[model samples]
Target: MTSDILLLEKNMHINVFGLNHNTAPIEIREKLYCSESDVPVILKKLKDWGLYESVVISTCNRTEIYFCSDDSNNSEESIKKIDAFLMEHFGVALDWLKNYTYRFCDEEAYRHLFLVASGLDSMVIGEPQILGQVKDAYRMATFHNTTGFFLDKAFHKTFNVAKRIRTETRIGYNPLSISSMAIELSKKIFGELNRKKILVIGAGEMCEIALKYFKKEGLTGIFITNRTFQHAQKLAEDITGIPCPLQDIPDLLTKVDMVLSSTGSEKPIIDKELVVSIMKKRKNRPLFFIDIAMPRDIDPEVNHIENVYLYDIDDLKGLSQQHLSDRLKESEKAHTIIEEEVVKFSHWLEQLEKNPLITHIIDVVEETRSNELKRMMQKMKYVDEETLRNMDLLTRSIVNKLIHRHISLIRQNGSPSLLEIMKQLFKFEEENEKEMDSGNEGK
Candidate 1:
């Protein structure tokens, strides 16, 4: 049992695969992006193909999948399947996959996840949005029943570590998000957003957050629009903006000085033709577009038009450099905190890995004792209640005494050969008997 537990600990490993902003360009990342609705299908496929647990975290900056297999021997095969699946499903080129995607196993994997959860790995280092994104991804995995013991522990610990970073360091102080960065770019494009009329497309969280920043900058006209008009109205009511219908986008584009768009749409919301026509209506007024969506809400070609400026999610990376430097010291502290938590988590997981085998050993021994006692009682004639209780207690005491050393050895140290001997003594499964016998024959 001791050796088996040790083997399990050695065999079980957490793995992570996929690309982030650092590894891949926005174009490559977007190709590999998995929407919230698309995650369950991927998770199910991964499980069907031998992954024990899985979670997919798909944000504008990254699309990473974390998973584990039941055995280490199967990990390579599982990773190959994942690579093939991601490439085929997303239509990613083989060269792109090799050039862009990253793979990490065990300590490296969880460390990457920890950095991601704590926002240290974000394009805007120390941004708080990635933590929430990680939580949402984990929650989605849980809802789909893809997460079990390993992932549950890893993610819960990640949350705690993120919270610790937030508490201990000033990393999250002033919290720079993609929305805040977009607002900053807008300020740079058109100085002083006060009294500026900005049309915000999509009333999602990103839009709401950017609107708050805009409101703080004293923006007077904030028009919110979405495919669902009610959602637009709700967000506009919350943010003190005017609610506009999706159909009114072209007309609104003619009026606003700037447009900030973030929607979950698969295709570009505003094309070059529409923007070109709107530019004519505005009489070549400098209209800036900040697209904070994954696939991008505004067309990239819109930047070609005279007096039109377009910035997608990747464009914000350059703007965040100064912000990243500002939080460098705090980020260092956060990294230190994450490393400490990673070590602690590794220790806890090791101890946890031993528990199942230990429990199974005790259960098997106890069952044997219980069955023998039942047989002995059936042969006896009319034993008193007190005697029967004493007999049960006697058997339990012997069983405990017999297995105490085995449990202690398991808790302390275990060897492979000893584990095999114990497995035979305790009548463990015979699946490996032939292999063991063949090895013995060579001796």
Candidate 2:
């Protein structure tokens, strides 16, 4: 049964391996996080190491590796090698990370991808952001031409399954956006945000999301700021708030009740000294700061400041999980859709196994019909052109009719014996032609 399944997948296949929030803790996952700018470089390295096609999805909750290859024997070794590379890259030991990783091959891998894209596999189930992240990864793979036929088909089907899950189920209904979860954490730290002045840094999607949630709480005067003043001005206008230059964060910090910073900067934008000064200016009023940016926008030391509460992106996990429980029914429904799609994709893969034989049979029938027609045309030069054309059509139709049932049977059952028979038939024909050539050489 294993051999038969392998034969079927020899045509097209997928394999997935990696760690996520479910299997690994944030400390372990953080080590595996590959930035968008780092992906092309990693892709080149994978190709150099003889791994042909791959897509790496590295998000806060998961870091999944998906690959396609004609050789199945290499899958396990390839994964181990990748694991070693990640350990070296992140300066972590293999022993610490190995136990957290989970590997899936062939159909299981494909199904897992669908579940991931639909957000069913998220640590906080039914989160909507993962779907976009998955699509972005797919688009990158496509741009790099690393996405082959099997991956292309699998990703397209995964996307369709994700759409069906969203449309058919209430999985996303009343879903807690990450920004809302951030706000929930703020409320826990500070009794009520309504009277507190809120400072939102950055004009990115995450900043906007945070703004919406804070606005819902009727926070005291909101300040929108970004490196790009126009963006800050635009967002401020949209939210009916004030705009501050990014450089003025230190000056404005003392006035704000809460600071929510989510930006693309690689290092901390708000340091301990700056925040300490702000705290002094505010007479050390309890200030809640949420840093949702990768690499973290706020310095870790800021948390130690008097009356200042600093929360990093990972700190919101508890609140996010709490929201996930309410959407459990929708998550189950999404899983059902994923399971059904996996079965259909597997059936398509099985049918593809007979494609080589089907192509061979069609070529042989066409060659035979063409050769016979040429011979008949040469022998009967007096035959009218219309009569000859009609005869040719009749012979073509008869050949197709004869091959139809065989083609249908091969497609339906995908029997290995039938493929072996086709291979032997071709081999015999080649041997007979070689003998005929030998006879001519003797003459």
Candidate 3:
């Protein structure tokens, strides 16, 4: 490859290093959980460490860092650096990083991103929330000026691919999100949801969405609480539910038959001790808990309490399979769309790599054609507008036809030998100057 092509290929070195729902359990994923504020810091850190482009996406189910550098050969070292950074920043163990994390480079990395943005790789197949999360991540990266040309194109293409899947396939038809699935599981635990009451902790997007599902089921006495009381009030107002302060969780827990929690809290908010006391106040009324938050808002030990059932994100996985079965056909279609986009994206990168030489080739050929045409026109007495137009069209067509094969060759396989030949053929500066001088003398 020529130096330009080599440089282009180097800049295409995109990679992702992190853990997701499939590769890591909730415990491992939460350890690397990057909140919104953490992304800019991580992006700046990566950039400081010499990455050209980077984006960090950390949701309840996955924590992934997508980055690129103009050193394809050093991808291994770069990924190792990212691994060590995650270990140190998240305080995760080496064993967990080795066993629970996954890394992908170039094509595989972009493919995984497409799967994620399209929700094909979600815990619940065809979930739509992940797309919004991916968009938010991309937006943050761009705001921090961490994404460059390659990542910008890749992410834009990813959005297009996701949109195509959404329009072409019915993957999102009656979609099942983590919240929806949690509601489904709750129905199994407590039949006739309309008769039972539920308390939703944390008024974030997930909690808000879950409340809507709960309301649709005609659930009575919906209570919402959050660390920021205003957010809880806003969500409750939107859903016609009751709003309470975070400190009131203990009181609310005793009255509601179920508790659905999804928050950004870094630790378990409702522990065994708290639940133990709440259960007594409720007379042990079989209160079910859905802890969908990343760090797990409810303690896992709470499951052992009598008449109390607990389900975290991992527990929701079993329920997802049932939803997946219904959307398998659509999921397959979405995967097909992703494969097509990946191939197109690869071709685009190849074209980008070969563009410098291609542009030179076109410039030389077009200038040569223009000089020759000028020389012919100078030889003639005068050319009418119709004749001039015809000649111009004929000359342009001939030039394009002659150069088309060479351009295709560069795009398909930009080998060093071929690049050198095109370079030599198109380096007509001295000859073009002489030809133009001769044409001017004739004039």
Candidate 4:
């Protein structure tokens, strides 16, 4: 882990432990949700406890803790402390949570972070939201110089990798928007959306994006309703649709051909009984329902109804998987770009390793020449101060010229083996000088 490889440096001392969507259900995820307001307090708590440097990234899909320290012996203890803090804060049992958590250290942690930034670990492959969330977390960690040299470099590299992924691959092309996929799936079952009277049950961002796709597909006779009638009305006007109050959803269900519901409600908005009644009222007409909410706005049992098609978030996972497979095929090119970047990063790390030693040697040589010239000037006091200064400059220039070729050779051709030799040589010289000084001290 060279100093020049910033990600490795920052993460070289970092320990990460967290649970993500793959390991936890919505019930568990909701419990671990740390609001934006809680970030500063959490950081302060970690720092106060001697964690020193820390960053918390809590999102819908993942919650990760990245903390830095020099104490290897306390690494496990620090992770345990973090786990205890989360258990206390979220009121979740440590037994239930521990199984889902993954702890990474050093180079593995650095690689995992890079993969996360590249969007390879996202629930929705190539989703753009995670990168923004990561950037926000990075920005928050920058306060009070908590980021340091390693984190600063690692994050910048992550951002650059994200940019390269976006540019070099078609991973983002033809992305399966949740709303658009719902409409497209409906079309597959029942022809075009032009004649369908679509009813959106909430005015959430997902519902809005869905509506935009529907409108673009020539969808008309749209109706929107929310708990807050004003929000529903605003969304309705924006899409040139009808606005209804939340209570009217039961009545609206029978009239509309398609229903898209995404509310922040804790319980199901549309149940099996309601859909069964609506299907009866519509005289066997096909009805499509999409529940894009976390706790699920629609009941899973609604799928049992005849002529009723119900799709929840989990249902969309299959479609997302298909899109991800397609994106993966395109990602081969992006992986090539990443490989090229890794090589470039490795070369830079090597150059940085050679720089400090060269600089130290140059400084030592220059200082020696300066001291020698000062002694010579004192002995030949008749020489004018101007002439003495010129001689001093001339000697310094001569030393620099003599060392330039050696410095250039090391910078251009230095390997790990060569660096090891240089380090040993420096150590030997220092040890020999110390021995000589001890001998003189005895006299």
Candidate 5:
């Protein structure tokens, strides 16, 4: 029901609307982020809103909502649906969100997602972690059965494009991640990491990356504590750090110089009261906390306490943002890759749209052949078997020849206008839909 400019075709198309690291600050991004638990609920809400084909990509740097719908004619209406859902779930109104967010439709929306999956849109510029994060989000969507045919196809293609970009270009070479920035932040504060006792919370990918970065540093004691002891022990064994239970965090808090947490907890694991008591044990020594988790594993109140510092994922972005010129060069190479892939995907989409017309062409020719053969038979005396066989063969050849050139032209790469011409040349689909609607009304 949207205008022609917004409508991609008469059917569903991939749509993306969200705020990312470039468009929004960390605070804004975090407020919009949907955690692993939150993704399904938000996706379900969107489904209930008739956005049955959708996916949510929420990370430290971005919170994106992608879905399939027919509001290309007026994307604001489609975006309003997403905006309303966000208002309902994330508590941000449409006007407030529009300033920070961007919207893309059809091919452009799909292209944007490909760039995101390939890490061309990341703060670090071609960071490798985003591809995996995107994959994980799609996997979650698949698990919940939220994505429909279009999304599933687009996301799968996006994964392949991301893989190609990483392989074909130097985009991922010498990349930086949020975990590396956290380590750099620590060095900035302590001037050196040689004597800093580090405690890592959680055994997730973020925590693993932080530990990997920390091991390379000259840090003194490294401790691993997580809710799952087996995971904690495994990471600690690999990193040669001591493994501790989640309960041991209070004791570790007192002894450690820095605590890097990346947990899946909904609530803050470290509060002001707990940290204040721990600081008392250390004679008011300074403690640095880096919380990379989405829901925030460390409380903001903890930052207010004396001799304690707290940094979330957003704070880490500043460190990674430096020297953007070098990464931007690599980003250009990724852009070229994405452009090629976008064209490739668009071609596939056009071919898919034209397929129905091709089917109709074949059907029309076959029906004409059948009706003409029956008339000729009625006008002649008992036809011989050989004559009948020859007639059938002759009609089949004529039909194939008649439509061959038209089908060939449709298959070739041409201007965008060619598709509209092909649709106009074949009116069967539109007529069929009209007849079906009329019949339903009559019934």
Candidate 6:
């Protein structure tokens, strides 16, 4: 195979091997999840291990790794290596991952990632959170120098395509999110959120979005708290609410009817004992806790307490599925947009595949034409400039027409055999030059 064709083939082997809501339950996903700070460390480790071009997208619903590892085109071996890396990082065994993981290769992997970034593959269809998470993963990969040219360009293109999909289609028509779905489920238990007091913990993106949904539903009292008191104070100012210092959470918990926690803390912030004490202070009234953080801010065991309803990220997936079923029409529209982008990018890849052969052909033809023109002028130096110009234009037209079909063919398929054949047939080297000189001598 020609070097150009070989290089293209090598780079085309993209693989996505990881677990998502479809293949794994929340328990498994949570185990596989990485905190945002942990993203760069894992990506750099992959780079050091030679899985250089890769991105890891970890959210409450899914934790997937997309990488290019085409060292020998052994897809099985490449996937195994990736799984082993995940096993080491997440402490999940490779055999266990086989049951809870889904794998996509080449174009399938590309389409899957596009769907994910477009929010079609999210637990909450059309949620805008996934796009930001996807960008964060790409950014982390870039910062760690783990991504190569193909991955970097592909990620930027993916972002553009995702934006187009969101805009051109009715997918985000209602603009629903996981946070909104959490509110929807809460309404089932608490009746109406407008009358209920809410406490928003952490001023991160997830927390910000959830707070917006709650505010839209209307609030009796809004309170914001963060590890950084200034961030909470800023968010509270914008929303016209109270900002409490982190130290005041135990006191604040008793005043709020609903608590939404989405912090980056590695451990549970509200244990069962803490929440139990807070419930008694509320006169045993119903208090709902929604823990949206991956590591979970509210203790799962808190659900055991009387009049304390605690739901973590996993509990809301069922609610999100309801949103997905309701948004089928939007999903179809988004799929159509993604399909168009796939074809466009696939064509671009085809052109990239043809670059080397195209360059070689152009170089030979232009060089041969230049040498022929110099010979014509060397012996006939007295010739007029216009005549020389006419000769040059005539040669250029012939080369353009002759090469046009090959370019068209490459755009369609760009097979390696065709590239090799073109290289052989388009040889304008020494023997052909000698033949041309002989023909001139005869003339």
Model 5: runs farther than 4 Å from truth? 1-9, 71-74, 177-211, 214-326, 357-443
After the best TM-score superposition of candidate 5, give how far the Cα of residue 425 lies from its true spot, in angstroms. 26
Q: Could you give candidate 2's per-residue lDDT for residues 1-443 as a string of tens digits?
A: 22223333344457888889888888888877889987777777776786667888889988888987555536878888787877777788887667898889888999899989988888767878899999888767655656544675688788889999989998876536667766666777777878878888998888887788789998879998998899999999999999998878877788887888888899889899887877878898888888889989999998898888888877776555655675896787778888899999898777765465554565566667778988988998698745764675477558868876777777777677876686576442555335434533543
Task: Identify the candidate with maximal lDDT.
Answer: 3
Query: lDDT for each of the candidates?
Result: 0.79, 0.77, 0.80, 0.73, 0.78, 0.76
What TM-score does each of the candidates earn?
Answer: 0.53, 0.52, 0.53, 0.51, 0.51, 0.51
RMSD for each model, in Å, please? 15.6, 16.2, 15.9, 15.5, 17.3, 16.0
Error of 6 at 256 (Å): 21
Cα deviation at 38, candidate 5, in Å, is 1.4
Taking all chains together, the TM-score of candidate 1 against the true structure is 0.53
Kindly report which residue pairs in candidate 4 clash with one another.
Answer: none
List of clashing residue pairs for candidate 1: none
Q: Candidate 4, residue 344: CA error in Å? A: 5.9
* Candidate 4 per-residue C-alpha lDDT over 224-270 given as tens digits, one digit per residue, 9 for 90 to 100: 99999999999988889999988888898888888888999999988
Ordered from best to worst lDDT, the candidate numbers read 3, 1, 5, 2, 6, 4
- Relative to the unseen true structure, what is the Cα RMSD of model 1? 15.6
The regions of model 3 sitting more than 4 angstroms off are 1-11, 177-323, 357-443
Worst 10 residues of 2 by lDDT: 1-10
Instruction: Please give the lDDT score at residue 121 for candidate 2.
Output: 87
